[model samples]
Target: MSMAPAVDAGLALLILGLGLWIIAARSNFAAVVGFMTYGLMLALVWVRLTAVDVAMTEAALGAGLTGVLLLGAAARLPAEAPGGGPGAGLRVLVAVLCVGVAAALAGVVLSLPEPAPSLAPLVAENLPPTGVKNPVTGVLLAHRAIDTLLETVVLIPALIGVWALAADRAWGARPGALTPRPSSSSLTLLAQVLPPFGILVGVHLVWAGADEPGGKFQGAAVLAAMWVLVVMAGLADLPKVTNRLMRYTLVLGPLVFVAIGLAGIWTAGAFLALPAGYAKPLIVLIEVVLTLSVALMLGLLLAGPPKERA
Candidate 1:
């Protein structure tokens, strides 16, 4: 008997098993680890489907960044209590229902026709004139600039909301009577190396995005990883709300993007319409500011205002 099909089948079963484990696990930490494993496997599946861009994103965001966030949150939670109340029959029923729904979704996707015709030809025809080889980037930054501008507005206010919530004294109070000491040695050599590696990847993603699937969002995420790592390890303390730079960073993207949009209205008779010869440079400039703003916002979310430095 040929072993190729068997190998594929086994891998598929293993992925399913991991998914089930994540859903059914009683321990939050175990569930997070299982979820990270599932993400890695899903990345491999994306590669198998010839979606290198999606696979790269899944590996970076899903397996790498999400795992860090989940593990950190899990570390702060209480240990699971013994003798859980759930019965085996209830668990089985829930699992079966979940599997049924998943199977149905998979069947629907598999039954869909391949090589579906799209408006890609139209996009391709005009991409060179737009000065961006990446159709998605052109659509996002040039064709659909309004949506991008609105998204930045949404992000700025959301960060303000988070800072407001973190300001609540009761909510921000340290959980235990004893403040947990920060340990530098707790971070391994690998952790130290990871941030710089993430920065390199982020810069590459930003530059590559002009002609590829990667873009500011992906690059910003990679930069956010570095910010998160430094914050978590206590290497760099968060600035107080009183800090001028902190406030500027929080509002920078929206302020710049909106100002540019309004300027475009003056020059081009419509909001966010790039002037005849400045589309590419303006988009790149906006992306750089957006990346920095996103990194700062994510850092502030992870690290509340600096109390006494450890």
Candidate 2:
């Protein structure tokens, strides 16, 4: 058998095993661990499917940051005594039901038309004017910019909701830290060693995403992870939700995107359309600002709702 098929087969089995393990886990923490592993494996599956952008997103948010967030939640919760859940018969019934659902999903996938329809050719024809070599970038920034713009804007209300969870007295206080204890020696060492390299990688992702399989979301997630590490290692503190500077950072991307969209009406006779020759510069400008804004917003979101320390 060729190596590619073997890899795919093994990946599929590992994913299946982890999914079952998560469902069967006796402890929430163990289930979270299994889910995280499943997420990573799914990212690799995305790569095998030739969707590296989706892969980056899955590994970064779905696996890495989410694992960190849930692990923190688990640590804070009272320990379960571990004896009492659905009995074996119910478990068996549930398993059968899950198998049925999975079978239905598989049926849906297999029933899809062969040689799936794609807009790749249409995107290619319009891509040169966008100045980005990445087709995904072109689609996001040029063809369907409003969708991407709104996606960024949506984070604002999410952060607001998180902040609203704070007690009225905690309004100006920082969010709860994900990792509040003094760092272990090894963790500190990793924190110090990783950020320089991590920052470099994040910037490269944003910069190259304009021409390759990376973009603001993936790059920002990497940057956010680095900031998260710094906080977890006790090297820095997150700003208060009410801080003027922090709020500005949160909205900067959406603000700039909206500005560009309005400018487009004058420059190109349509919202978010690039001028005849300035496509590259405008896209780069948007990417750079949005990267910073996105990194900040995601970092804060992972830190949870703001509240005063007792």
Clashes per candidate (backbone, < 3 Å): 0, 0
| Candidate 1 lDDT score at position 230 | 62
Q: Would you estimate the TM-scores of all the predictions? A: 0.75, 0.89
Candidate 2 ranges beyond 4 A from true positions: 77-104
Best by TM-score: 2
Residue-by-residue lDDT tens digits, candidate 2, 261-300? 9998999999888888998999999999999998998898
> Where is the poorest 10-residue window by lDDT in model 2?
77-86
Q: State the displacement of the C-alpha of residue 75, model 1, in Å, after optimal TM-score superposition.
A: 3.1
